[model samples]
Every structure is written in C-alpha cells, then in structure tokens.
Target chain A: MTVTAKIDVKNQDISESIRKLLEDILKTEIIQAILVSQHLPMKKMVMPTLVTDPDHLDGIDPLAPAFPVNAATIAARLTRKPIGEKIAAVLRPCEIRAFIELVKLNQAKRGNIILISVDCPGAFQNKDYLKFAGQNPKEATLRFYKKVMDGNAVEVEGVELATACKACEYPVSENADIQIGLYGMKTDESILVKAQTEAGDHILKQINLSATNEPAARQTAINSLITKRSSFRDEMFLKTTETTNSLEKISSFFASCVNCYNCRVACPVCYCKECVFVTDAFNHDSFQYISWAKKKGIIKMPTDTLFYHLTRLTHMSTACVGCGQCSNACPNDIPIMELFRTIAHVTQKAFDYQAGKSIEQKPPLSIFCKDEFQEVVGIND
Target chain B: MSEFEPTIVAFFCNWCTFTAADLAGTSRLSYPPNIKIIRVMCTGMVDPQYIIKAFLEGADGVLVSGCHPGDCHYINGNYKARRRIKLLKEILPQFGFDSKRLRLTWIGASDGIRLAEIMRTLVSQIKELGPSQSKLSMVI
Candidate 1:
C-alpha cells in the first residue's frame, strides 16, 4: 500500500549513494535547502548544516557514527515558524523521535518540511568518534556502515558504540516522512528508500525513483536488531534499578554532578521557557549552606546536586526518548541517561505510553483518562 | 530513639486541604502533631521539588493532600497533581527512600475529621518504617 523505491549504490559505496541522493533532492526547485550532517572545513567533526547549494553537499555524511548533539531543538527553532520555503532534513531515528516529541510539546510544527530518516547504525560518543575517525571522516563513516551491514563487529579497536545506541530498540525510522532503508538490504549493492507518508510520496515522485515492494529481509533485519537491543536494554534497566535502588546509592551515583545542568541543555524535549534551576528560587543565601552544614556537621559543598537530578527526572522521565545525549554531554560522565532511561522505561510502561511514538497520542499528563492508571489511585470496584 | 516521632511535611491545597486542616483546628480533632503544613493555591502548584527538598531537609515523610479529583477550584488541578505524585512514587523508591514515605490523598474542605484520620495513619505508617536513614543519619 506504501510507495517504496531503491537508490543504486554508486561505486559500491553507501555514503556516495546517499550523498548523490541528497544532491538530487537539493537540485529540485521545490526544495529550497537541506539540513544534514557534514564535515566542517577545518575540523574532523561532523555537525548539522543547512545546505542551499547542491555543490556544497559533497561533504554530507549522515551515516557517520557521531552524535555531538540532539538536533531536535534546532529543528524546532527552524520550523517553529516557517521562513517561506520548504527545507528537507535528514535525521537519525532518535532525532526524528525527539523532534516528534518537540512538536507534541508545541515547540515545532509539522508543515513546510520534509523529514528523511535512515535505519540508524547507532553512534559513538563525541570523544570516541574523534579517536575513531583519526584522519578521514568520510572513510570512517563508510567503514562503520560496512561493518554494521556486513554483520561484522560493531566496534573497532577497543571503542564501541554508545550505550544509548546499543540499548535502543527502535533502529528503523518510524516517524519520518521518508525512510532511507539500510538494514535487511545487500548494502554493497543498493539501499531501499521508502516513502512512509503522503509528504514522502510527493517528494519521491519529484525525485522519480522506480517503485518497489517492501522486502522480507528488511523486516528480518529490523526484528533481529531490535531483539539484540531489547535484551541489552532490559539488562541495563535491571542493573540500574539494583545499583540506584536506595538513597545512598542514588546520592553517590549522581554525586559527581556539579549541578552544571548540561543534561537539561542537551535534552530535546525539555522545552520549558525558563527552567526553575536557573531562576532566583535556587539562589540560596550564604547562611543557608552554613545552616545545612551546621546541622549535618558534614555536607557536600555544592548542595542540591541530588535534588536537581531528581527534579529533572520527575519533570522529564515521561517525555524522555532515551537518546542518551545526557550522558554524552556529561563532563563527569555521570551516566545520567542510563538512570533516566531506566526510570523512564518503568514510568512510560506504567502509563502504557511511548514518548514520540505518534503525534496523535496525547502525553500521559496532558490528558487524563478516568479509567487509566486506576491501580495507582487504588479505586476499588 | 525514645519515641521515634517522624517529621512529616504536608502540602495542603488552599481551596480544600488547607481548609480541611483549618476545620480540624477549630473542631479540635486529635491527630499526631507530627506534620508541618505548607499551603499552595492548588495541588497542581505543588512541585515535586518541594517534596524532594522536604526529604533532603530531614522530613521523614511527605503528605500531599488536595481537592477531590473533580472538586478542584481550578477544575483539573487535582488530576494533574494525582498523575505527578503517582509518578514520583514510582521513582522515589529507586533513589533509596521508601515510596511509602510519600502519600497522596483527596481530602475535601469539610472533611476535617477525615484529614485528621489520614494524618494519624500517615504518622503511624512512617513511624513503623522508622525515621528515614538518609535524612536522619546525616543530621549530627
């Protein structure tokens, strides 16, 4: 029922094929610009760039195993109020999911943009990526894709993919208007690009790729990848629950956090206009710290580190998409993502809701059903 | 360790729970004098941070009493409060505090006796759990 197509892998390179496809999209008069990850001229780092000229798309590489930031908020800012022409964005599964959550939070709009997503091969943390991509970023991306597609080892040398990626069960982009399929295909040959929405169908028509059928192998690849990730996710949840199961452990677990609030900054769905942490309310008087210390005789220098994280967890776990960027952004590497995700997994399941699953489904707290979570309220028949 | 009287922080919604506490005072209802009440405009106005700060400030337990689900002065404040407290309950235990330390209940403006009864029960429930190890053991 859905329109699917294939883009021939040029010169036996998946990255080249994707680049050429993006170029073709930019060439179209209908699309004004494209937002993609490209290698910076000076640094080896790859970040999201809005490319207007098709010629500049030469360095575009969305397949790289590097996620420096969650671009959902960026997309939100860009699309919050349209700037006349349409823009095509190439995002990962997590990024798309985060953007969807933003849209639900009323931070982003769904109109006047094209969402192109790919089967995520997962990513490495920023530091790990720099070490892995020593000189050639392009080749690093290709090698990473080839290994993942060939069913070879996921890591190179000693560095592996980030834990968030490994724990992620949704590898396929279910929310994108256009899904660029990599899994379940012979990537040395060609990768399938399927249109998942009416907007996707319209854009594919403009590109003029030959229509195809959904392959059986793609579903198999998706299932196996998810199964592997789900087991790891469950293991992570159990381990996190056990370790941080008590106040002492929880205090020590987040003790490294200097109350920097980097996790809040990096969170895609934490879309509050003004956070309570930054407000004057947290500005305790000089006497307050002394008073606390006088009572305890010994106290942590920077108070409320534990309190801050717990507050974030309460405010955010419901909307947490489990992208793991929080941990990635940590200077102390506090593993904030693992704790939040572990708790989020339980909270989301308790409400029978999945964050960013669809725009139609209301957030648990936003709309209340009289019958739902009745057990929580202890309502006897 | 003589009697182990639990220090409880109770958040009372102004329109209902706060009034219930006032009525209890006027009616001379006998409940454990264990709680310190802070009144907010509505239950929805009670941030989870206030509860976390209470436990951190060495309160052995927290009681969040609001208007009945449909009886909120602001229409749906209690509903929102219910959802947040229910979620907070799930997460608090994993952080080393017993989830039972936090209690959420609907007490109407006229239910002064009911409010006292619930307060009595909460104090006893926390008394049995003993003073929380995190808050008590830290205080010198």
Candidate 2:
C-alpha cells in the first residue's frame, strides 16, 4: 500500500502549506536542491527557480496560472548530465509527461531527480496570464486556485483557461513519484500528499507527516473533470480537423506564419539539437526563389512555412504531451496546439502509443518489428 | 485532351529495388516512363522529409521499395522504412493527401519482372486517383 498523508492548512492557504511541504523536502539531507516555480521578486514573473536553502521558499507558487515555458525543458537541462546530487522538481502533469518524453529520448536522466506533481488545475497562456495577474500576481494566483477548487467555471475575470488546458484530459499525473492532491479535498483542513513510487516512499519517510487515506471523493472529482475535458477535446479535434483537412485549408490555417519558429523553440519535445529550418540549408539561392516564385506566379516570401509545420508534425507528434506551449509561443496566434494535438491523437493512436505515458514504452518510430503494420506494405492495397 | 502521365518519384533501395529496376531496364521489361527513380543506399535513409518534399513539390505519387523484411542488406533498414511509411500514411492523410499516393513495397534484386509489373500497376492506380492535391492547388 502507498503512503498517503495530509499537511495541515492554516488560514486556508493551500499554497503556503505546499511551500512549507517543499521547504521541509528541501531540508531533507538527501535532497540537494528543490526546483519549483517561484514569483521572481523583481518582475513577479513565475519561473522555475532552484532553491538550496529552505528560507528562499517564500515566492514559491507552483499553483500560479503563469506557464511562460514548459519546465520539462528545464528539468531536462538539470538532469541531462548527472548533477551528482538529488533534486526534487515540482511540475505540472504536462511538464512531468514532457519530462518523461525527454527522459525516453535520452535527453534527461531520472536517476537523481524526484518528480513531485500536484493535481494540475491547468494554466493560462502567457499573454492571458500577464493580463490576469495585472498588478498583483500572488493575489491573482490565490483567486484562480480558489475559484478552480470551488468547482466553478475557470473564468474569474474576463480570461478563461487556455484552450489547451480546457481540453486537457490529464488533470492528475499517474507517473509522478509523489503527488499532491488538491481536488475534492477539504483544502480548509489539509491537502493530500501521497508517495506513489519507492523513491517517493523513501523521501516521504524522511519528512514528518501523519498518515491518512485518500478520500473517496477525490476519484469522483478527477473522473468528472476528465469527462468534461474529454468532451471539450473531442469537439476541438472535430473543429481542427474541419479547418485543416485539406492542404489549401491547412496552408490558410498557417497563412499568417512569418517563420519565426518560436513554436518549435517553445515545444519541449521538439528534440532536434539544431532545427534544419533555421540552418543555412533553408537559405535558398536567389535563382531558386525566383524559379519558385515564377512557378507559382507569386510565391510567399520566407518560404517553407507549411513545410516546416508538416515536418514538425511528422517528427514530434508522437512525442507530444499536449502541453500547448506551441500555441502560447506563437506570435501569429496560430492554434498550433490544436493542430498538433489533433494530429498527435491520431498518430499516437495509430501506433497504439501514448506519449509520455511511461519511460518503459519505447518511442513508436524508434523500434520496429518484422510482422507489424503489414497493411501499409505492398502495392495491391 | 492529352492523357495524364502522373509524375511518380520512386526511392529504390540500392541493393534490392534499385538493382531490380536496373534488371528490368536491361531485360527490356518496359515500365512506364512516369517513374523517376532515385537510388538510395536503403529505404531506411529515405527520411519522411524527402517524401513530404516530393508531395509538396507536386509529385503525384511516391514509392519506397526495398528488400523484403529479412533480406535487408543492412539487416533491418526495410523494417525501419516500413514504420516510417506507416507513420506517413497516418500523418499525410490527415491533411488530405490520399494515402494511396504514397506506397511501400518489398521487391528483391532478382524480382525484375515483379518490379516492372508493380510500377505499371502503381502508375495506373495513381492515374485513377487523379493528380494529388498538391499538384492541383498551391501548397504554400
């Protein structure tokens, strides 16, 4: 049986309790640093900060609605080579999933990291978050979490959750070594903390907390959220498919692309060390551009926008964790996440694969067998 | 009023399918002139980008034919190619490229007659399917 415990809440401040929990985790002798999102004091922007001293935990707020970047990329950086010390990372469900994909790609090592995920309430896009936070980020975070925990609509002010978050089905991470539960709990009383793996159990043993059982209501709450999100996701898939079903339509869908390539940079699973699109290979000869323009009668300058997106779909769709960072990073406001997730859903399902589900499951394209997918072979079909 | 001769780009594996094409040519087994074969070391090296580039540049059909499963000169290149083909079939169709426009086959070096026959059949099949969408409209 897994160990489940509760951290007492005073003044009904769940974030403060979680901060204290992390502070305690940081105090543990085995842990060298704890990586958690913090409101950087100067700008108050929520970014992942590594903390070695427990006193630096004041600005830590993993519950904030700000997701400027997927911390999986950061986690990959920390664990790419052994840091020689154990670190605990507090990540969202999607970040953990993306980190898992990075681990499978051999970009990240899990040997010295403890993954601690909470019941993700989802996050807003970067622009929407800045608007939502306005002058008081910490207060806005408190309001956001309270409204979400109250089981009301996510729209607090004029802003709603990012489309990607609304359509996400994974509100709870199953792969986390330790999970902090907030949904369906009496947050005024205490929050749920459970050790899901042997690593988590080892860490939990070091922390002094009273044991408790997970409330039956937690499962029900998670199920309802999943149902709501799945329906939204199905609707999104249909709409995205309609908009991008044809090549012409897909081109129009990305018509505003300036080839900034910010989306790929923001993507945690876009695993290339250096993308070919940015390399000199795409720098065509003057005559090549002239010929291309002459052939089409008029070619769009800064060519290969559609080609880039399609190539990315082929390369990264199977590894996509539906983090929606692509859409967040788009300067053109392209619904890149919808297009990617719709295609990713089909691609992953075609291979009977779910990206980031487990480290043990090899990436679909990495390994092949003698007798599978024969339906794709032969000219007769 | 003229007949539509679809342009097909074929990536034939150097050891097996490319040799088969050469055999067909020397043996006077006439395959349609529509197929422009690019010999590669293995179908495994025919990255998805190459196929996508062909389609985007208005090639009506793409074929990657290599050694049979256990007969790969590289001992598993054909298998890897099959997985990539399967991936493309899943991805390309989502954006309205008829999945039939792309094909994967296994034709051994000695199967010259078989290679020529399959090419004719593939050309006819694509001809019936009409020109690919990329050919009919602007891709970018």
Candidate 3:
C-alpha cells in the first residue's frame, strides 16, 4: 500500500517547520551541510544560502517570490568534487532537471549531494519582487503565499510571474529524493511530505513522520494546476511559432539583440569555460573591417551578431530546457527563450529525446544511429 | 577595372578536396585566387563553429569540401560532415544571414578541374551577394 503524509500548518509556521527539519538532518550527520533560501539583509529579495550550522537557518525562507538564478549550477559546483560528506541542497523542479543534465555531462557529481525539491509556487522576476516587497517583506510574503495557495497566480506589483513559471508543466519535483509539497494544500493547514526514491524513503523512515493518505482536495488541486499550466504552454508554443516561422522572420524577431550574451550566460547547460565567440577567433583586424565596410558601404557595428546567435543555437539547443532564464537575463528583453524553446522542441522531438529527462539517454549528437533521419538523408532504401 | 574577388575559407579534407586543390595548382588550371584553404584530416573535424568563426572574422563565405560520401578516407567522416552541414544550413539562415554563404561539396583527388570550377562559381556567387554584413558580431 502507498503511504501519504501531512503536516498541520494551522498550528505551526511552514518556514519554522522546514528549519526544524533541516536542523534535525544537520544534527544527525545525514547531511554535512544544508543549502537553503534566505531573504537578503535589509532587502525583500531571496537568494540561495549555504549553512553548515543549524543556527544560521533562522532566516531561511524558500517561499519568497524572487528567483534571481537557477540553483542547479550552484549544486553542480558544490558537487564537482567529493567533499568527504554529503550535502543537502534544496532546488526547484527545473533546477533539479538542469543539475541532472550537468551531472550526465560530467560537469557535476551526485555522490556528494542530497537533492531536496519543493512543490514550486512559481516566482517573480527580480525587479518586480523588490517592488512588491515595498517597505514590508513579511506582509508581502504572506500575500504571496495566499495568492499561490488560492490557485490565483501571484503578481508582484501587477507584473505577472516570469514566463518560465507560467508555462512550467512540472510543479512537483519528480526526481527529488525528498519532496516538500505546498501546491494544492491549505496554507493554514498541513502540507504533504513524500519520499520519491530509495534515498528519500530511508531518510523519511529515519525522520519517523507517520504516513497518511494525501487528502482528495490536494490531488484535485494538483491536477487542476498541471492542466492549467499545460494549456498555457500549448498556447505559448502556438503563438511563438506563428510569429516567427522562417530564418528571416526569426532574425527580425531578435533584431534588438546587442549580443550581450546574457542568454548564453544564464543558460544552465551552457557550461563552456571558454566560448569561441570570446576568443581571438572572432576578433577582426582594423584593415579588414574598413575594407569590408568600404565594399559594403555600411556595416553593423561590432560585427558577427547573427553568427554568434547561430553558433549558440547549434551548440546548446540540444540541452535547452525552456527555463526562460535566458529571457529573464536579457537586458533588451528579447524573446530568446521562446526561440530556443521552439527550436529545441522540434530538434529534441526529431531525435525522440527530451533534454534533462534521463541520465541514461545520451545526447543526440554524442552518438550515431544508423537508422536515424534516414528519410532526411535520402537513404530510405 | 579591378576584378571582383571573394575571400573564401575552404575547409578541405586532406584525402580528397585538399589534394584536388593541390592538383588544380599542379595542373596549372586557371581558377579564381579567392579561396584560402585550411587542410583538415577529415571534414568531420570542421566544426560548424569553425565555419561561423571564419565568417565572423571577415571571410565573405566558407566552403566545406570533403571526399564523396562513400569514399571518406576516415571511413564515415564525410557522412557525418554531411549531416552536420545540412543541419547548419537549416539553422544558420534563421539568424538573418543567407545560408548560401556557407556551402558544402564533394571533390575527389582526381577532380582537379571540378575543384577549380567550384571555386570560380563560389567567387562569382559571393560577388553577386556582396559582402556579408548582416551576420556581423555585436559588442555587448
């Protein structure tokens, strides 16, 4: 028989309960260190914090609206080498997926990190979050939770959640060892707790929290949320495709790009230590520039804008996960996420693969299949 | 009047296209002095990034010439290059540059005349298209 568990939130605060959970894990040596989210000092923004001492978890608040960066890259860095003891790291669903991809690429290790995920309520962009917090952070956090648990999308000062969150289909972390459920539950009542893997089951058994069947209301809430997000994603895909179908149209779509490369930097899977664009490979001599300009009569300053984007698409499309961090990081607000997600959707589908879906699945380019794309190759004999 | 000349970066496989280019020179066949060939062991070693980098560094066009599909010196390098170049063709144009600026062809070591003909054709085509400026790099 499957077991479900609940925590009564009416009698206790969610943040305090989470702190206690981490404290217990720290004291028991299950995790040598714990990484949690905390509000920045004198600011309403939340950021990732690593804490080895349980006392430092007092200000940890994972429920804040700010998602300035994905925590997967952090987890990858933390586990790049063995640290002698396992560390527990909390992340959102997308972050966990990104981390898994990084691990498969040999950029990270799983032996030294404990993965903990939470039922994401979605988050706001950084600037909007600060405005929402205004002069009082506690009230803003309370309002944010109320809105999210009530199934109403939370907004920060009228700006909606980031496009990434609005279109996210996975609110529950499927790969997490320990999952803290928040969606589809009463904010004033208990939250659900579950173990998804052997590691999680072992930890839960040690924590000794009695299991109970998840409430029917919670299941209904979760189903409705997933359905809502799925439909939104479908609508977005259609709209993006219709707007830009060909290369010329897509180039116009990105005409505002100044080649800041923030999108590349923000991408979790773009792990190149030295990108070709930054090297001497793209540097052109002054005479070459003048000669080209003289020939063409005009040139776009700081050449190779289109080449830069095309190079990145070829290199990173296979690993794109539609996180929208690229779009979030853009100073020009280019719809880079939409373009990448659209192309990646088609490319990955053509290969019958999904980025970051499984560790066993090799990237399409890394391996060759004799029967792959036979029709396109005109080898349909 | 000065003749229209094109600056082409030719990524030629050592076994075939490079030899064909050398054969063209040895046969004294007249071809446009437009192409500056970079010899690679196999066409598969010519990463799409390298082609893009060439264009970014002011090469008006790039030609990736390798052995015939079934005749790659490295067994399957030409086939792999074909797949990669095909994908690059599909994707490069989306960034506002003409995909024609990047070309791929097969040339055997015996096909010195064909190599010269391809160079002449590419130089004329690039001249017609003029210099590639739309795909130029942007400084942050």
Chain B, per-candidate TM-score? 0.94, 0.98, 0.92
**Candidate 2 or 1, higher DockQ:** 2
* Minimal lDDT window, size 10, model 2 chain A: A149-158
As for DockQ, the candidate ahead, 2 or 3, is 2
TM-score of chain A, all candidates: 0.96, 0.98, 0.93
Write one digit per residue (lDDT tens) for candidate 2, span A146-197: 8887544667687989889999999999889999999989988999999989
Candidate 3 at A39: error in angstroms? 1.0
How accurate locally is residue A170 in candidate 1, as Cα lDDT from 0 to 100?
90
User: How does chain B of model 2 score on TM-score?
Assistant: 0.98
For candidate 3, the lDDT comes to 0.76
Fnat of candidate 2 is 0.83
Sort every candidate by DockQ, greatest first: 2, 1, 3
RMSD of 1: 2.0
> Residue B80 CA error for candidate 2 (Å)?
0.5
Q: Report lDDT (Cα) of residue A120, candidate 2.
A: 85
Candidates 1 and 2, the one with greater TM-score: 2
lDDT of 1 by residue, B1-140 (tens): 38998899989999998999999999998899899898999989888889888887788988888888778899988788778888887788777788788888888999999888888878888898888876645521
List candidate 3 segments past 4 Å from native: A1-4, A150-157, A215-220, A242-252, A375-381, B1-10, B20-38, B51-83, B86-90, B93-140
Backbone clashes in model 2, listed as residue pairs: none
Q: Between the candidate structures 1 and 3, which one is better when assessed by lDDT?
A: 1
CA-based DockQ, model 3: 0.21
